[model samples]
Target: MSNLSKLESQSIFLLREAYRTFRRIGMPWSMGKDSNVLLWLAQKAFCGRIPFPVLHIDTTYEFPEMLEFRAWAQKHYGLQLIVKINEEAIARGVGYETHDPVTVTHELKTVALQQALAEYQWDALITGIRRDEDPTRAKERYFSPRSSEGEWNYKDQPPEFWNQFALPPKGAGGHVRVQPLLDWTEYDVWLYIRREKIPIPPLYFARNGKRFRSIGCRPITHPVPSTASTVDEIIAELYSTRTPERAGRAQDHHERNAMQKLRAKGFL
Candidate 1:
C-alpha cells in the first residue's frame, strides 16, 4: 500500500478502536480543515454513518462563512452537530475586544467545552489533533487518556506497542481523548482532501487577493497574504511555507507556551 493508504488504514483503525472501547463518545468539529477531514474519515470508517454526535463550541465570534459551511456540511453528511455556546461568557463580553485572547479562549472555548462534557457524559472524545501541528501536540499518543478533571499528563501516557492501545479503566468518568490523525501533517491533510474529493469551505481559496492559511475565530484569525486560489495551489504553497500553521492564530502569538498551557488546562 502507498504511504497515504497506510495512514488512512491507521486512522480508521484508531477510530474503530475508540468506538469499540468507549460507550459514549463524540468528536469536536471546529469547522476547520482538520475537523472536516476527521468528519470525512468518520464516514469512511463507519460506511457512511457517523455513530456519535459532532460537538462544535460556538464562541459566537466565528466568521459568518464558517457557520454557513458548518451547516452545509452537517446537512450533506447527515451529522448530528451539537453546538455548545458559552452564553455566560458572551453575555459578559469576554472576547478579544474586551479581554485578551488567552482569557477569551479559556472562558469561551475551554470552559464551554468542560460544561458541555459535564452536561453529557462521554466515555471518550475523538479529536483531530495531529502531532505535526505543534511541539506540544507532538507528545500526544494515538489514544491518550486524561484524568477525571480532563487534565492530560504527557509524562504518564500509556504504552502503544505494535498498534495495541491500552484501554482506559471501566466506569472512569473522565473520557479518553483519541487522536486518529496524530501522524498526519498539514500537507497530508490537503493531499487527502484532494484524493477523497472532499468539499472544503470556500474560505480556503484565495478571494480578493487574500486567503486564510489557517482558520479560527474571526478576531483571532488573520489570513496570510497568498494568491493560491485552488486546492492544488494551496498544496504547493504548503511545500514552500515554513511557518507554523497556527502562526496566524492570535492566541498562539500571545504567549510562547500558550497552546501547551491551554492543553494542560484541558483546552482542546
Candidate 2:
C-alpha cells in the first residue's frame, strides 16, 4: 500500500475511536492545508458524511480569501461548519495592528477557542497538529488530555505504544484533544493534497513574485519571493528550501517559547 493510504487508514481508525469515545466533539478548521486535509479525511472516515461540527475560530483579521474558501468548501462538501469569532475581543479592539501577534492570538484565537468550547459544551476537539510542526507539538499524544483550563501537561501525556491509547481519566470536563495527523509531515500533507486533487486557496500560488509559505492574517503574514505557482512546483520548492514552514509567521518568531506558551494556554 502507498504511504498516503497507510496514513489515511490510521487516521480513519483514530477518528472512529474518538467518535465512539467522546460525547460532544468538534474539529477546528483554520482554512489551511492541514485542517482542510483533515476535513477531507473526516468525510472519508464517515463514508462521505462528517459526524462532527467543523469549528473555525475566526480572529477577524484572517485573509479574506481564507474566509471565502472556507465558505465555499462548507457549501461544496456539505460540512456542518460552525464559525466561532471573538466578538467581544473585536468589539474591544483586539488585533495585530495594536497588540503583539502573540498576545492578539492568545486573546482572539486561544482564549476565544476555550470560550467557544465551554459555550458549546464540547467534550472533545479534533485538531490537525503534527509532531514535526514544532518541538513542543512533537511531544503530544494521539489523544491528549488537558486540564479544565485547557492547559496541556506534556510531561504526563498518556502512552501510545503499539497503537494502544490510554483513555483519559474520567470526569475530566468531558473534553479531550484528538490529533489524527500527528505523525504526518509537511511533505506528506502536500503529497496527499496532490494525490487527492484537493483545491486549496489561490494565495498559495505566486502573485506579483511572492507566495505565502504559511497562511495567516495579512498584517502578520509575510510571503517569500517564489515563482512556483503550481502544486508540483511548490513541492519541488519545499525540497530545496532551507527555511522552516513557520519562519514567516510573526507570532511564532516572537520568542523562543512563543508557540509553546500559546499552545500551553490552549492555542491551536
Candidate 3:
C-alpha cells in the first residue's frame, strides 16, 4: 500500500479506537487544512456520518475567511458543530488589542476550550495536531492523557511502540487527547487534501504572492511569500520550501517556551 494509504488507515484506526474506548468524544475543528483532513477522515471512518460533535472555540479574533468557511463546511457536511466562546474574557476586554499574544491565546483558546470540555463533559477529544507542526507537539502520544485540570505532563507521557498505545489507567479521571494526525506532516496533509478533493479555506492558497502556511487568529498570523495557488502547486512548493510551517505564527516568537507552556495548560 502507498504511504498515504497507510497513514489514512492508521488515522481511521485511531479515530475508531478513541470513539469505542471513550464514553463521550468530540473533535475540535480549527477550520484549517489539517483539521479539514481530520474531519474528512472521521467521516470516512464512520461511513460518511461522524458520530461526535465538532467543537470550535471561537475567540472572536479569527480571520473572516475562517469563520465563513466554518459556516460553509458545517452546512456542506451537515456537521454537529458546537461553537464555544469565552464571553467573560471578551467582556473583561481580554484580546490581542490590549493583551500580549500569550495572554490572549490563554484566555481565548485555552480557557474557552476548558469551558467547553467542562460544559460538554467530553471524555476524549479528537484533535488534528500533528507532531511535525510544532516541536512541543512532537512529544505527544497517540492516546495522550491530560490531568483532570486539563494539563499535559509531556515529560511523563506513556510510551507507544509498534501499533500499541497505552491508555490511561481506568478511573484516571482525566480526558484523553486523541491525536490521530500525530504522524502526518504538512506535505502529507496537502497530499491527502488533494487526493481526497477536500475543501480547505482559501487563505492557504497564495494571493498577491503571499499565503498563510499556518493559519491562526488574523492579528498574529502572517502570510509568507509564495506563488503556490493550487493544491498541486502547494505540493510542489512543499517539496523545495525550507520554511518552518508555523513561521507565520507570532506566538511562537514570543518566547522559547511559549508553546510548551500553552500545551501544558491544554491549549490545543
Compare the candidates by lDDT and give the number of the best one. Answer: 3
lDDT of 3 by residue, 168-251 (tens): 753355799999999999999999999999999999999999999999988999999999999999999999999999999998
Give the higher-lDDT candidate: 2 or 3. Answer: 3
* TM-score computed on alpha carbons, candidate 1: 0.96
Question: lDDT by residue for model 1 over 190-254, one digit each (tens)?
Answer: 99999998888888899887788778889889887788999999999899977678778898879
TM-score of each: 0.96, 0.96, 0.98
Which ten-residue region of model 3 has the weakest summed lDDT? Answer: 165-174
99-160 in candidate 2: lDDT tens per residue?
A: 89899989989888888888888888999999988888998999988878888877888888
Off by over 4 Å in 1: 170-172
